[model samples]
Target chain A: MLSKPNVEVSNKSMLGRLFRKNNKNIIGIFTVVLALLFISPYIYIVLTSIKPSSDAISSSPTFFPRQLSLENYVTMFNQMPIIRYFLNSFTTASISTILAVFLGALAAYGLSRFSSKTGHAFLLLTLCVRMIPMISIAIPMYIIINVMGLIDTRIALIITYTAINVPFSIWLMIGFFNNIPKEFDEAARIDGCNVFSAFIKVILPVSLPGLATAAIFCFMLAWNDFLFALLLTSTNAKTATVGISEFLTAYNLDLGPMTAAAVSFSLPIMVFSILVQRYIVSGMTLGAVKE
Target chain B: MTKESRVSIYFFAPAGIFMLIFLFFPVALLIRDSFFEIDMIGQGRGAFVGLSHYVDAIRSERFIGATTNTIIYVVVAVGFELILGLFFALLLNTAFKGHGIVRTIMLAPLMIAPLVSGLIWRFMLNNQFGIVNKLLYDFNITSSRHAIQWLSDERFSLFSTIIADIWLTTPFMMLVLLAGLQGISPTLYESSQIDGANKIQTFLYVTLPSLFPVMIVAVLIRTVDAARTFDIVWVLTQGGPSNSSEVLSTYMYKTLTRYGQVGESSAMAVMFILLLLAISSYFLFVMFKANKK
Candidate 1:
């Protein structure tokens, strides 16, 4: 934009052209500054995580760390059950994604293919579930999990995560399935396949991109959850999110290891998201495609 | 039952059962628990106290403060995010080269756990050694010997949390609005130009109306999420500086987890749900109304 053709020297239009050129330059500069504002904290955290101990806590702040080292990360690994937390988070997140996607696909198929007024109402009511804050349901959930003797278990977290994410998954699937021709379902029926087999052998295969998108989203939502993990789990099932939170309350000493822990906690999911962000656009924009 | 209805029933069974068991049953229990004084340990029932817990929470200073703080936080944060998101969406819609990299960087915060960003914000808001303070001093916004209490002082703690939240969620608003922006046809702009419309008029008459649904969707999502804000408040101040920054989520959490007030916390939860439900219903109505139009 800044490389646009230069203004020709003409008396009548010189000022207007100059003003337009300057406005473009202003927008270009503003865009870069805004990007830096958004990106700087992550960079700062990463740098602080790896900075040598001497410079990490130095009274004078430095933009870039002088001596890069892995000391803080080493300490975080040794001192905390970071690996266990990661394992728990990963296991629960994956299980929840699979469960949510499967169950949501089923419900969405029922709603989309059946197309009853009752099904429409059910879908609308489920949309309301997205508005129900997790914290509101948490008090009873805590007691309910305890009542069932499922407290401090990854399955508890997985069940809760799946339950919460299912509504979203269902909505996304409805959007995806709506686009698929109903004639395909008819074609399968004409071939003598039942509804279940028709979905499995026909619709399911073609909706891979949509499934991948929804699955990735469910995984992300479950992985990033902290409130559920906090309220639901005890020591055995604590997630990486709660593990990092404890470093604040329990290990409140040096910021180095905490930052290191924070970085490492977020690194895998961050990289995962960056790789799959293209899918996020399709997965989440169902709001734009809705009735 | 007919074959199709049976198939529908079979397909819906897993999710329907799961929600009824986990989500709805728990909600029923929450409503019941609010009327009883329950044991902290076993959660055994005590005495039936009808509407007393609700009354007390309604009258409580802490709850009132938390409600006030939540309103301020949600209003300021979501309002700012909308304006800034629309601004950036407009910028992104320029189709400039390398904007893809910028878009990825802008959205990096959304991918990571919001809890981590809350922690990072806490680190950045440290008065003594934080970059925020350092930058302030660099620009002579403060003295080397003095720093603003970004999270420590009562005046700035909630504001600090809002800034962190803005950092975390604005990308989401931007992406949603950008999707909305991109959905508008270029022919609309050409028609507006053909009619001698300027930038301001084109934006007011053409862009805003077209983006309304997306804007409504973005607002609905952000507002509900903002109302339930926990991670940032917990990490930053724990609703601290003497409860000045306490949001409903942190208040409800601390009430149950710290004070062990199950009955009252359940009441608080009830109130929180109703409030959100009422507000969200209004938004949902608007959404469906817009869709009809």
Candidate 2:
């Protein structure tokens, strides 16, 4: 026997109270605050990049730039072969990613489809390599690469990175390929497709998300690499990481150009992560825990 | 049977050979090199000074410092990253608006290369013109009017390295834990709630038990990574302020590449690898046991 006006008012108040009590609201605020903290250094870098060196070095730092300047960016380009370094990083990372992914997928397909002790062994080897620290390989790799006369070359970087990433790519792809119902592959085979053809036609299309994740990981590994890039490549084939290292010299450090260089170097990985975040997270953590 | 076997071998041969050559072969060479007394300048000119390099490395004060620092680095960094990562994961797991974007942004540091992260932090931790100091001063948090010498001081350099490491790696831990959290069924929480359980009790009984396996794996990975940390420390401190920040890898690199003592470095590298292997194997065993249970 409630009046319509009274019923409507009560409903409105209940909804309002629900909103006030919702835990999501509290969580949302907390997450935003933490996210801002996570990105604070990068934000500071961007702000510092535009400010004059004197302002940057001042005891009391300004939060915002009073005057914006492109001097750091300009100086970074002029002082070093920034473009050449970028090209080196790009070409090496791209080629390595392509090679690693293709070969990894091929190997993963074979491993997942075939049931054999050897396949298991291959999988074990992949995991072993993934776990071993890179220093274990650095000196011998140096010796071997030197012997091959491939010092200070993009090919050397590409080959090393590709070799290093293939194991991970294969391991990741195996899980993805495994998750797909084997019935699809079986049905394709029954329809007169060979294993290779079925993998190409059916499996590849279905595992695009997995492939993308692996490709991004491979690219990031090659791109962000420093130790191999530092030891193997001199100025002739130095990547962005090596280029950033050159910002610090024996006599003096250029803070402005260094910040600008660091920002530019990190931009690609940042964009890629933002673009393909969903796959990267799921793919990286796919086989980490068993159901 | 023969034909199928042959095809399988053909499929695996490329990957297998690559690992044996590039991965196993290098480790073998490291072992071989560790036994020799090779100077840094020469390519391979050395005598077979069996165990001499190992003896020297064990006795070296720098090696001892590196070992101590490496242990401290791994324990502190991994411990803190795990705790912080778990906290953030729990925060993000709540049904929140814009949670997805926040999660992605939190993962930004993980995606960036360690060297680049080191450089980024180096800029931020700079005594002059660094924003950390700026913020501290702006908020009147620290009365020390000068920019903190983060890398220059040995006492604070390890902590500085830890900060950068924790920043770079906590996302990895969070991602793993988040995935683990997702695997958990909501029905359990609902049942607990029906029993008049509070948030903390439900989380302790349900969430913590389910997350144990993934947490172990995540911690293991982070521990191994933290123990072998080189690039960030290398870029930031380079084991400076009188070798106070030197971890094992940096110590090895300095001996071989910088100080021209290849044999000693190789021995140090071998020891470092063995230590890591032992730790990782133990973790793997724990994981297997957990899975069996």
**Candidate whose lDDT is highest:** 1
Off by over 4 Å in 1: A1-26, A116-119, A189-192, A249-252, A288-291, B287-293
Lowest lDDT 10-residue stretch of candidate 2 chain B: B3-12
> How well is each residue in A1-291 modelled by candidate 2, as lDDT tens digits?
756778788989999888865857987897899889888877777787787766655656776788888888888999999999999999999999998898888878777767645456656766567666776667667777887889999999998998899888888887777788889988998999987788889999999988999998899889988889987999789998899888865433587788788888887678878788887777668657665
For B1-293, candidate 1 gives per-residue lDDT tens digits of 78887887888888889888988888899999999998788767999999999999999999999999999999999999999899988998876556788788887777877798898988787765677788888889788724788887998999999998898888888988898988888999999999999999999999999899889888988999899999888888999989989999999999989888889999999989899889888988998898899
Candidate 1: which docking quality band? medium
Against the native complex, each candidate's DockQ, computed on alpha carbons, is 0.62, 0.61
Instruction: Report the error of model 2 at residue A39, Å.
Output: 1.3
Please give, for residues B1-293, the per-residue lDDT of candidate 2 as tens digits: 67655655566667767767766787888889889877645576689999998888889898899899999999999999889989999989885888888987888777888997788777777776466776777789877745477878778898899889988888999989988898898898889999999988988999998898899888887888788788999888898889989988787777766777766777888888788878878988998897899
Judged by lDDT against the true structure, how good is candidate 2?
Answer: 0.82
Winning model by DockQ: 1
